[model samples]
Target: MQYPEHLAHFASLFKKRDIAHFMSAPWLVSSFREPVWRYNFGFKNDQNLDWRVHLCDGSLLTDPQHVKLLNSLQCWLIASTENAAGPGFTNSWAAQSASFRRTLTVIDHILQSAEALELVEHGLSALTYDVMCDIIEQIGTSSYVAVSTYDWNNRLTDYCKSLLQTTSPESIDKCLEEYPTLADITPLQLEENELEIPLELISRVRAALYINKMYHSNPNGGLNVNSIRVSALLYKDTLAGKKRLKPLHSILGFIWRRDRFIREFDGVPVTNGNPDRMTRRDLVLYRTAFTFLQKISALDFKLPSKEDLREIATFKVTGTAMGRFKNVPTPIIFKAIKDGIELHFEHGPQLLKSYLNIAKYSLKHMVNITGIPDETTISLLEPSIAELGVQYLGISTRSSGRDPGTELKESKEIYFSKLRGNAGLLELIGVYYGAIQLLVGATMAKRGSELRDLDPTNCLSEDKSWLIARIAKSSRGQKGRRARNARPIDPLAAEMVQTLIDFQKDLIEIGFIDQHLPLFSSPGIIGTSSLTSCDVYLYYKNIDLFCDYFEVERDSLGRRYYIRQHQLRRFFALVFLHCGYGASAGILQWMFGHTDPAHIWNYITEELPGKELRNTLSQALSERIATGGATHYTDVIDLIESKFGTRNVSVMDAEKLAEYFDFLMETDQMTMEPVFLESDTGLRVDILVVVRKQDEMG
Candidate 1:
């Protein structure tokens, strides 16, 4: 019954080709010469795989070695499909045909690019992991492609290991090239960033956010939009020089000149110009005052034409000629501030107060220099200034009240220079949520979507220790898989989660925001509904605003640092990996949920990701091991001693540690455990390593 080597492979290919054409999936077979897996995503017979999976440009498909490996891969593909519907209709990927084929296309790229096609005789061996890594390194830009490829292959590797039973390699995604190098992390500057974000920064940022949220939630949170719009207009026209405000500003220019030179405010001292000079520093106020005079005033006031000052007398309303009436200041200033009050309550004081102070200073300075306006102008201008000041400006003509700035300061609403005050209600809310989102994103290893979709009602368990979130990425191409994973959070993260829950509840209760939205939804955000989805990508901008507001500084190297959700996720992974010393990388992978990590391992869960990252934590671990740094790792060390004879063997020469590491990885499973060891400094140092043998899988 035993066939010779070539005959055995020939018979195996014959069986696989038969299985392809006769069994579960007949579409997979193109021809005996080359059984490339061609897929039809369009209709039942529509073969638009239009994308194809082939080996070695049609040259290697007939090779005995390739034929066998390709046969096994095809069988796995056929087995991967189940009878469910498609995307949106089902959660499991195999439930739909398209998802599996789409994944094969990603794999196809690696297959086509992989060199040394005959390196492995059959199936995806450890050698295939190396080939995959080589292709992964040359990739650019599309990081998602890299993540997806690794994830799908990891699943494939899992399937292979399950079949092999005793030869499982935990995960092939353990390559560190995807991470930044050690030098990239050193000399970490705030302006130019490093690979890792310091926990101290995250902590300090959280505290700053807490204080800011508390600080801003006062005085009804200044949701007022009036000040924001007004200041932006001013800033744009002045500094931006987009220079679009010409016509209106020009009109304002003349009106200002007329007011200053011809009919100067009543009580001020200097002799009024013989109808001449003027200048203006504008913002929304110039437009507002001009509009109040022309559009809102009953006087039908027309600005004086710059061509003639003598025309001031002719430009009057129903009353005496305008030039003769000295009372123009009071009525104009009063009407502009008063009428807009109902439309913009905060608008009058904050917007026009600065202008009012300027007017009085100019008025007083004129009074000191020389000319006085006639009695008629005096009575009108003086009384009007006092009235406007007392009522709208919050200034007391009777007794001293408070400095305007001091009053606003006490209200503690955020104010930016140039009147860009308090309009950040929307951005502030974003910041508040951004802080929570960053904290949650960093602490919880959820995908951006999972983090965005967290349910306020049930995101937490009754005990409040475990942070529960959905798992979708790994569920791709699998059926009936678990959809959610619950992992423990530190005390601070737990507290933050609770606070988030409470905050969402309050927003819903007040009907200020709708209920049933995800915790991060933009409910109170104008134009958004409770059912709308919020992308986590936008959270970084809000976080940056928070940083700018709080003056989050750079590190010692002066490189500017920016934080992204992915970086936070990686940092968390790194922290969990090295934290109590030799904390298990395997457990970190397990917690990440690429495999049924729960099935084969004990859940002393902890965290960390992939590609030959100089910054990849394996180097860190290797360095630690070489130095004999970690303490109390008896079992792994004993295993090390049993094989290599002594811990010193790894440290002996340049290549020995590499061999030692290889030996440890060759075992069924390796993990580090912490044990207290006496250090030279007399401190209690808890450090160690452990290895789980092939027999320990049970």
Candidate 2:
């Protein structure tokens, strides 16, 4: 890399040892508590010399061209380092939006366009402190702008301090003058002004702003300037020549006017009438994972080996053998089990020699309960799952199946610990294993209160008959034994359990389980810890990889439709609700481990049961009103009175009313007809018409 005379001297001050020391130390010198005289090679020229040549990549340049490349090489390295190491470099929306165009311009300079160098140089220089803050007033203003931008409309602002508490309903008129984006309505002030703003009003405001229906809505409609500006950083790459270099202006126009693709509320971009939950990068990752999964499924892969099984299964040597007490060493009991299994072997290798068929019964059971592939369900398990009680048999909640003592927030450790496991998960697995053993005519009789207490004999059986296992509880306050009952498994449930077992075994055989190992592991962590909540997200990444691998086709509108995990959970909840399942909301709330049913509401569809019922009743009433039909005489009387408020329609008898109407119709003293009209909601209404018959004739 080349450097100017003064800059070269500056660079020479540091020896190789000094550079090494600097790398190890946070600060420059031992005495210095701050980053004093820290080297920054990307300084803008004080003389304001043309820095166009400085933006170019310098690695390919000859020695003769080094002088010409000095500024460009230094600038490139500095920008690259800053981008890689700077705070908020990857996640900051503002930084990404601001630098993306300049980054592209530099790329263009390196590849084809020389003119872009000037633009890139100018952008980079503008970002420098000297250019951004030339005067003291400019410095102060820039500082204020930075602070204001970061804090303005921050979500963390005090509830009372925000628009809700500070601005009264009476002050709304005055507030509108400043923030005219609010809907034009006279708000009723709350007596408890100190209370947090009503979320309902926020919703209404969001809805109004989303449609750009606010009094002083921006001409650009719902699209925000920041998103458009950020989009420009990408859009500029499409431009091949200088004529098409109006990146900022063109992007803003396309987003706000020409394309009209993005929508925004409160300066934030939204999609599908909701705030976009995922970023573009996340969407890309998911798409890629989905493609990968699809491709693997289509490939018809072979079964996994014993080594492959080890990769997917979250097993540790800490637990005792299947039949032994918790503290017993597993090897001491394994000998008998291995011998028994080996004696029963047929076409396969000896039980101990191969991974195949070994633990097939137990694995089958686990799969039946999980109902999904290992990779898919790995995230649902917590890191502390192993520490749970043996009696629970499966993943338990952080509180070990007990509710927290208080309403106070659970720490991340405790929250993730026992988030609760469905007994059905472990029980179903056990049931499947038991069923398989029963089919083999193995000894299955066990009497116990809980399913876990029943232990099936491993020894082979001579009799091929169904086993009757009884489970009865002892009465707590009475001496008499409780009546024993045989619990029955429904045919459908049994079939699904069997099917899941088969599918899981197939997954194991095909080596898909082998690929699930790293996914199940917590990245950068060692030991037998289960995947944390964050690690579990690797499942989604796996999906993204699958989609990418298969090059999945986009939708009819050329858009990729990726399913998120949360979306799947919501769909499951909604399905339960739509199927008229009893206590679905409560069930979902329990399943989701939500303290309040309202949290589960997010999973519910917008067309709620109450809302739908109301709509249906409203439609029925509307139809009756439109047809001028009355279920009762009072309904007719009420309708008549509504039309003719002064008339005593209620006093007239049904026969008298009929006779009067007939006389009126015959004598033309009154007229009756139907009047049709349309309402804003698009409903067509028909009204019964009665007027002075003589007046109409005249």
Candidate 3:
């Protein structure tokens, strides 16, 4: 075979390596006489030619053939490296397979042609430092070192300088024109600013400069900013720009339209002298403002200092200035009375009297639970105006009223009725409220509630006894039906259901209800009550309850009764079919349920008699035959002696003998022949009589 041009070139280069050439020249000449060595010349040992080894060692040559080939190739490689030849630089072991080396070498020669090099240089420059690094790494260390020697002498300074100064001003101008908008420029500048610029505007400008530089250098494609770290920093700095460069118009917009209803009334008191007469409207607004402030305090922002707010006249006063609104907002003040009523109802009539006294005493003294002025409280109550001679607390009510006092008095009546309607209502409310309070308290206390006790069902009233009774009854009924239908009882399925029920109860107790439980309550054919007869049987065909029972029994002797359930069902079907208890159609449906008759026939024919019974029958038959027992005495003695064993002496023996005789007679004649008597003088001899005497002696 003719060697490719590049391969021939490689061979020449290898021959130039001082040590390799000196060692391989004699081997290459000798290889011509050895077919193995000749064949190895084109064989690739390291197909990928990964450039990791500093020297190709003889140890890598698995056979003498590889050794001879590598030796010749190594000499050629060294020569090419020394000469800086095209074949040396362009040849890749990956492309030069033993089967295709000639083609690959031709390709390499073509690629290194003067015409090809000139074409490549028209629009592209020499490789960069990074690209050179990649090449050096790809070539083995020995080749890399050889190439490096040449590179050090030639140097790549001119290539580096050319690339650095390659950008065109026209390209930069074109990029600037394309991205002239502030949105684009500002965002780009912001990204660059994150790396080095501290001033937001300057950083954005720097990013813009970098982008413009890349755009000018690569005019055909946009900037390729692929670094994740750089991208994250860019995003972060852009967000900072948002905070710093917020438009003046936006600030003005906020100033002009921000809601100030709460601020306007902050320091002004609705309740002056009469704390009892504070209105509901003032109370509602006061509570709403307090809620808003509480929410604000929970946020991440640094709140403005009170002194700062005071310095800025534009800033509004808040709830802090009014102190606590206990007496001033009479509705909040009246919460004590409402709470007393709630407590009284919760604890029943006995505790009611005590709470009422507490309410009366507080009312008589005009004591404040929260400390805002009475005038402010009255103002808060004005909106829910009514004429019931009681203060309106701004809570919605069905009663119509125009005066504050009437609305308040009516609200008090409404609140009392709501408290009295359900005895367990307060407890229910307490359960929910206490759970929330417990969770919050736990957060504050840093001690969590037990998961088991957090269930909603645990909070159900004792009055729900009726519901429990109903569930228990339903469960019992279901179990009873399952027991009856699964006659003799499939303990395994029963146990499975029981376990599932226990788990479900546990979930329910923990306030988690699984929707799938009801579906699993009755599973397979038994669960699908609509199925009947053979249909049910076929549905449960794959379940292997009988086999499963047998396995279970085999594993544990005491669990033998587990097989009874399936066995009894089979026995019932067999007996019913044998007894002609129903019409063929009805019996078929009953025995096999709605199954195809062919399937039923197949099952019946394929099924073996129960193992225990089959064994018992086999043992009995063997013993009878061994004893020469016979039941029928009309046997031909000669036939019996010639065919089956010598006739049994006893009737049991004769019966066992006749059983074997009958079996042989029924067998295929070609496979087995039955015994026949062939006597010159035919005597009326009974096989059973002859076998009886022999059985007795034995």
Candidate 4:
């Protein structure tokens, strides 16, 4: 039989090197085991660590000691409970009165309000089957038994020697039954120069058994933090060739060496022999590294200060800094790689600064040559230092590599420049276009013909002045009294309807409407053609592509300014809040199709800055309600002096003052409160406030 040249060469190495030394002791190969996952892009160190699981099924170990080992393993795997029993003990001595009971209930409610519990439940969804098995096996085996650093290659080699001396067809057939389709796998056969035989057959069996240790033990494998920690420790111990039992000493050459197994089960490190200390220290180090990686990954693209730079330098895995993490554990090394990435990220701002300095010096020289060197004009050429560090390494500008003069001649950019100058027109046009899409979608979605049977004309009526949209579904009430059927939109979306009416009339004269007289032939587009949802996406995609037209940076994550159709609800809702049209949560909830008022709180809080916004808003509402009129800042200060005998209202900014006034209106503390003011011309003016009644007030 002939073999490939590569196979023959690989077989020669097995003949020369003892298999047990090669398979069991990875430390002999290298002091530091390379990790499975690499942080930096480079050629990897050879992966020499291989735990043979396919051979050992644990069925080989059947003794009374094994049962005791299993029990201890289970005990070690049990989770330790941290008690909050101090409150319970305190309550035991205290009175069991109604007030005391009420206080306890309130405390419990506060405890439950924490968001950490919700986040933990979310994280639990990511625990996979392989992760669970790794944990459980580590606990049960006690870094002994199946998890051996005791060289099986040596044991197999000795067996092959005896088989070679007494070579027979029957014995070979029996060996083939166990590991079929293999020859010259052992040391003796390899020593005989049988290069044509499949020598990997023995190692392949070991690999299969190792896999079985992780997942094939049970149908529904289990997982917890303890299992993960313990498994990592076992892997470390195996690689280091520490605290392994001799094969001849264990019962049936498989069960735990009774003395060492007990120590392992007692929470002693198999490698270091520290009782009551298993893999906890190693696990902590790994976890700490993981946490650092997570933090670095989540860090926003901000320019790190001097202190942040110092902290980042400690874990960096590049240049001279890589020496700091050279001999650290694999997990820690990965963490260092993450740190290096963050360091690189932070350097972006510094790189930008360097480029600017070079530009500034060049500009000064050029201007000097021109004989009109103005320091201010040269300084103006420098860009402002952005708060965010640059994510993209390459240099880019709003002109898309073209000079500003050349860009100005482009039609798209010219049109965009005009639109930017007239913001009100831009907003009104966006609102009009967005409203058409929404109304059409809503009407179609309600009728259950959104995707399949879209005929934009079906939404139109005889009168071209109005359009309707289905905002909510009709539901049965008490005594089968059904609610109103798909409410009309003459008032609900009045601004959009009116804009559509005018737009349709203009387009109708151009002969663009369908036979049914709908405003859209199919749907409305930014261009002269009809559009759909797909068209809307393509429109925004093109807008993003033409970022130079809008004078904004293009990001890999998509548009920094280009608007999607769905964002219209959030846009208009924010507009309603900022413009003092309708700021209450209920109005926002209805407009945004949110069932819970709490969901709206996050949006409102994000929109309105200041840590004391909620408190300030509440206080302002109370003051306005007490006054029963639209109170100016001057009047409010007077009221404060009368109540607290002090005036501090003058310190507040105009923006803060407006926020308070808006808060009063949104909460309906005082409805349409009127105020009389004297203008600069000494003319008396009547001002109408924007407050509307809340549901409770009504």
Most TM-score-accurate candidate: 1
Number of clashing residue pairs, candidate 3: 72
Show pairs that collide, candidate 4: 53-209, 53-210, 54-208, 54-209, 54-210, 135-227
Ranking by TM-score: 1, 4, 2, 3
lDDT of 4 at 237: 26
Better of 1 and 2 by TM-score: 1
Q: Give the TM-score of candidate 1.
A: 0.36
Q: Please identify which of the two predictions, 2 or 3, would achieve the higher lDDT against the true structure.
A: 2
What's the TM for model 4? 0.21
Query: For residues 597-691, what per-residue lDDT tens digits would candidate 1 score against the true structure?
Result: 23212332323222211122333344455567643545656666776677673464422343344335423255433333334643131323446
Q: Write the per-residue lDDT of candidate 2 for residues 436-546, one digit (tens) a residue.
A: 222121111122122222213211112312222323333322233343333223232233223323333444464434322211121111101122111212222322322
Maximum-lDDT candidate = 1
TM-score of each: 0.36, 0.19, 0.13, 0.21
Give the Å shift of residue 569 in candidate 4.
Answer: 10
Q: For all the candidates, what are their Cα RMSDs to the real structure? A: 31.4, 33.4, 39.9, 31.4
How would you encode candidate 3's per-residue C-alpha lDDT over 1-698 as one tens digit per residue?
A: 45687687456533422342232321132332232232122233211221111112212222443443333333322322221233222444322221133222212222223143331222111222232233223222211221212221112222222322454545545544554431222211221221222242322332344443321211111232222223222222111111111111110011111110111011212112211211222222222221221112222223223333223322222211111111111122123223333432343232212222322333445542122222332343312121112232122211123332332354534533332232112122222222222212111111111111122332222332111111111122112311111111122222222333343354334333333233112112111111111111121221122212112222112321111112232332232222221123443343343335444434433332222122222223333334543234334444456665555544334324434432332221111111223245421111212232334434
Count of clashes, each model: 25, 37, 72, 6
lDDT of each: 0.35, 0.27, 0.26, 0.28
The TM-score measured for candidate 2 stands at 0.19
lDDT ranking from best to worst? 1, 4, 2, 3
Runs in model 2 deviating more than 4 A are 1-63, 66-71, 79-112, 116-501, 504-584, 590-698
Candidate 1: worst 10 consecutive residues by lDDT? Answer: 251-260
